[model samples]
Target: MTDELRTTMERVGERFNLGEYEIDAYLAVLEHGELTASEIAAETDIPQPRVYDTVRSLSDRGLVELRESRPMKIVAVDPGDAFGDIRSSLAEMVDELEARYTAPARDTEAVSLVKSRSTILRYLEEIVADAEYELALSLTPDLLRRFRDSLEERVAAGVSVELLVTPASRAPSPEEFDYESVATEARARRGITTPVIAVADGEYSIYATQDALRDDRDRYGVIFNRSALGFLVSGFYGTVLWTTAETLATDGESRPFPRTYASIRRAVKDVHELSGEFHVEVRGRDVATGNEIHLEGPVLAHEFDASEQVASFSVAGEDGDPVSVGGLVAALEDVEAQEIVLDRS
Candidate 1:
């Protein structure tokens, strides 16, 4: 808060001062190019008594021109001319404020609440760009476009991305969009009820409503950055939202082997679809003792519940004994796998 910066900020605030009534009255006059005080009250909800004062305030700020004739007409000044001086001042003020801004502690906070649409969007982009292996996202068509480049970067880095775009009809067709470059698989859901979500490596995630992406003041988004806690988001996405979505695109190219995963469900699904013998190396915690364990051997068997709520796989250990591995916060299985690597040689 240097003196120069604080002075500039106060000057900008004073020059652009606008209240609810002033805004409504200004818009009414702008829409019609000019309006009498009575006409402004008719066009907007601004009370008849307040229209004169509101317009007078606008005139004081050089946003509107007032005629002294009968009825006192208010004319809209060209916005470009009206805001010319303050526009530069506002930009300077923003630069000064941003210099003083502190970034949110994403790595330290287990969970955080955010309200701005821009902040939510920024976190979504960071999540997609930061994924090292697995990614899951539910986005609108507009958001899909906004983060397309980041998704493509992750896909090229061999990250597995499962994308869900809502309002099926509005999603781009395969001909119009290159799905192969952005996702391992993509699905479309039929309605706007889907919340905007992004999970990175099954750990970092954000959950927000569609309303949170709009100009509305009442909406919010939540971020979850703790390890293992991400399964809450991924589980909900897989069991509830992903199951109901219609597949739109899937990468047809053969994926290179030696794949890695932080999710047991995805690992089980991939391993089950393979034909020949495949080996798995798992790093997880023993369900019984909660002690960390590392196991590696050929896959023996796997199970998936119809509802996708439960998924696990068995692998032979060094002692040639079968050990069952499950996902985060596992209950029934022998091991709660934090990471699984699948390789076929």
Candidate 2:
């Protein structure tokens, strides 16, 4: 063989080998079906003295079977069967490693600059998935499509999602896309100049230039980790973008059954949006009894304060008496519909 060809073969062998001579010996047996140690060393470039050790190593790794014949032959295991246990071991290792691993603490800096499009998209997806209570996003039509699954998952998990897509003409029309499955409310901004923005639970936020989506190489985004900094992004979204945007779609019937509300106003608003009389299940601690209460009744009236974060709602039981209950929104854990009978009988 040419010197160049020998070097190339050695490089190829190195990749598949557990150690020197192992891959060469395994390949020799695989091609020849069964080979004695001396035959393996002769078929490949392995040294005669190391052939037994190489084949023994292959045997121990289950890549080849060893037979104690007069010449002690090495037999190659089928590639699929040989690697099945290794594949399973690798998968198990990954699971155990992930379970035992602890992620490093994030840097406490309030603001960070990210310059890669892939990285920016990754953080955007993470922000959406991490949201607990609410999410607000301003996305290019492309980004809206890219994050459709992530947004749908969060909404299905009971996080309130409000989405804006720009420029209005480029966005999918309500008939073309199922926005109600992903976002509680969706709108289309009139201009292309609207920057991509996202705020999660009013705590984490990201703002990026349109170029971030238009040019992968020229991508950039700003991340705000602190709530104080996040508010600036949220403020810009609420005051400038949200007010001027035209509603594309709204899903009043798709609202999540309220659970662990942070804002009483939002909770009350959700309850009010329900179509007709619905049975309510309120789960909380009874202040007087110091015991857990699971109350079910028809809601009579509901009131809430956005500023004070307090809510009072009444429910009527079978005896036709209304019981008034009031609490801080944070303390009200869950209010779910027990039944939604179409008929008012």
Candidate 3:
């Protein structure tokens, strides 16, 4: 190989350092367009064991196509055509990611009402695990007891967990929930649960209601996710959470919680544009320490990006200016940081 060719090879490797193996394979195909693994090995002087690996990687990255012609050839894609495919693939990926993270429900009208217990449980698990922080739930004594182990795992992950148990559920003092049990379970797992709604981490809220939820395989569970209906369920049954063993533990007389209707007139304006989006609302850390801070929000209206290092962010604001998401994340991490000062362009 000539000096210029060597330099280009090095540059190709450098450019694709992040993507690694695939890009190297693509470069190999570019230099020797029609070659089998053995041909690639011989031309590139790569080890025999790695020849197949490189050829497969190149094919996987869509840089080279394998064919069954005269010599079992591998053809390199045209530069312009190859790049167009990559760009299109990335665009589709971003769309799918945004849908899962930003928009929870879509394209379900014709999928048949998924009312099966197994399906409901699976959906509930997906929604629950995706929660960024905090999970507010209301369940009877029977239900909580069943999910006790799972809740303990969530609480231990530095997540705030607040649960209210009605006094009437147990006549004889309800088995004091084991703190040791809580701690031990937490030690064995990685999870997080928030204390309550104090500037909640994630916007979407998940709730489940069942007379008796058990580990039994035969039983079915009903779990549904909805911002509009959840707002109502949570608002109306606020007492189920407020009347804890602590509140009624000291109340002059136990009383049933009154229905909540404070937010009855609230309207849920559809944020349709938010479909399939991931938003990182970067702020600053404490000014004194100059640490980094980052907050991720499920958003459709925001276009945001930040580098790995807490340097700066690029987000289009109401006015259309380039702002730094990483910079903002750092600013918010600072103790003195204030309202999300977005970079508006």
Query: Each model's RMSD to truth, in Å?
Result: 3.5, 14.3, 23.7
User: Total clashing residue pairs per candidate?
Assistant: 0, 0, 39
Residue pairs in clash, model 2: none
Superior by TM-score: candidate 1 or candidate 2 = 1
Full candidate order by TM-score, most accurate first = 1, 2, 3
lDDT of 2 by residue, 204-287 (tens): 889998888677445789999976577678767865887688988887565544443422344455666555654555555555
Clashes of 1: 0
Model 3 stretches with alpha carbons more than 4 Å out: 1-114, 171-175, 179-229, 239-345
RMSD of candidate 3 to true structure, Å? 23.7
**Candidate 3 lDDT by residue in tens digits, 234-318:** 4433323332223222211111111111111100011121223333343445455666444434322422222112222244444
Q: Which residue runs does candidate 1 get wrong by more than 4 Å?
A: 19-56, 64-82, 215-218, 304-310
Q: What is the lDDT of residue 117 in candidate 2?
A: 80
**Residue 41 miss distance in model 3 (angstroms):** 77
Report the alpha-carbon TM-score of model 2 versus the true structure. 0.50
What candidate 2 gets wrong by more than 4 Å, as runs, is: 1-104, 216-218, 257-345
lDDT of 1 at 231: 78
Which residue window of length 10 is worst by lDDT in model 3? Answer: 261-270
lDDT to native, each model: 0.87, 0.72, 0.39
Candidate order, lDDT descending: 1, 2, 3
Candidate 2 least-lDDT 10 residues: 336-345
